[model samples]
Target: MEPVVLAAGTALVAAMASDAWEAARGALVDLWRKGKPEEAEAVGNELQRARTVALESRRTVDPDAEQALIGFWRMRLDHLLRERPDLARELRGVLEDDLVPTLGAGERDRATTLLGRAEAHDHARIYQAGRDQHIHGG
Candidate 1:
């Protein structure tokens, strides 16, 4: 379980570098450029907190650490979703189709269920378009 946790955390951190941090920085920069330095700083601080938590978490094997890591990822995802819903949808699909399938059985089931709930919540107010497509023609 420790190995599995390490592997998952590492993979997730790598993805975070490419997705979460990059997007957060871009948004922060945009905020800064638009005369919202406080907002930009707040976002940067949150991102730093997330990374600090992850780095410290990698040194231990506590079950509570897993939830902290998960919370970091969830917050990152939520930030991205709010800033760019279309990209968030694409990223969610990528996670569901690729990353989730590579996890252990229990983790995979949990991830799948979570993704379903996320999708439903994201589209809660919108009407469906068809059987295969989401309400937004997604």
Candidate 2:
């Protein structure tokens, strides 16, 4: 779950480097509004600020600054998820349909696809991840 949020956050910020980021921004703001209706305008304003920093960091060739922006967005998304878990699937939709598609050819390489499934029956428990995973007392 954390990994999925991280991937989506990273992809959304990466989309900021694209000229088509407005569409992505709109999609995200719409999602935020759907989940927390009162925060729609605020989220749009915040995303705009993030976009500004992302573009500036790119122009200065400052990867660290862009990384900081990704971290910030990731935290924000995490909170949003905590507040409204139902939006999780819609968040993924925005990532795939809006954010990733906004990336340019060069930036597209930074995007990753993750698939995870956990199944359990009776006394069993399952933990799944797209990459690394750990099991205790299995």
For this target, which candidate reaches the highest TM-score against the unseen true structure? 2
**Model 1 lDDT at residue 21:** 49
The ten-residue window of minimal lDDT in model 1 covers: 1-10
How much is the lDDT of residue 72 in candidate 1? 58
TM agreement with the true structure for every prediction: 0.43, 0.79
Off by over 4 Å in 2: 113-138
Clash pairs (backbone) in predicted model 1: none
The lDDT values for all models are: 0.47, 0.83
- Candidate 2 residue-wise lDDT at 132: 85
Cα lDDT tens digits, model 2, 30-110, are: 998899989999999999999899989989999999889888988988989999999999988888788878877666556
lDDT of 1 by residue, 75-115 (tens): 54555446655554445444544455445565555554433
In model 2, state the lDDT of residue 36: 92
Model 1 CA deviation exceeding 4 Å by range: 1-60, 117-138
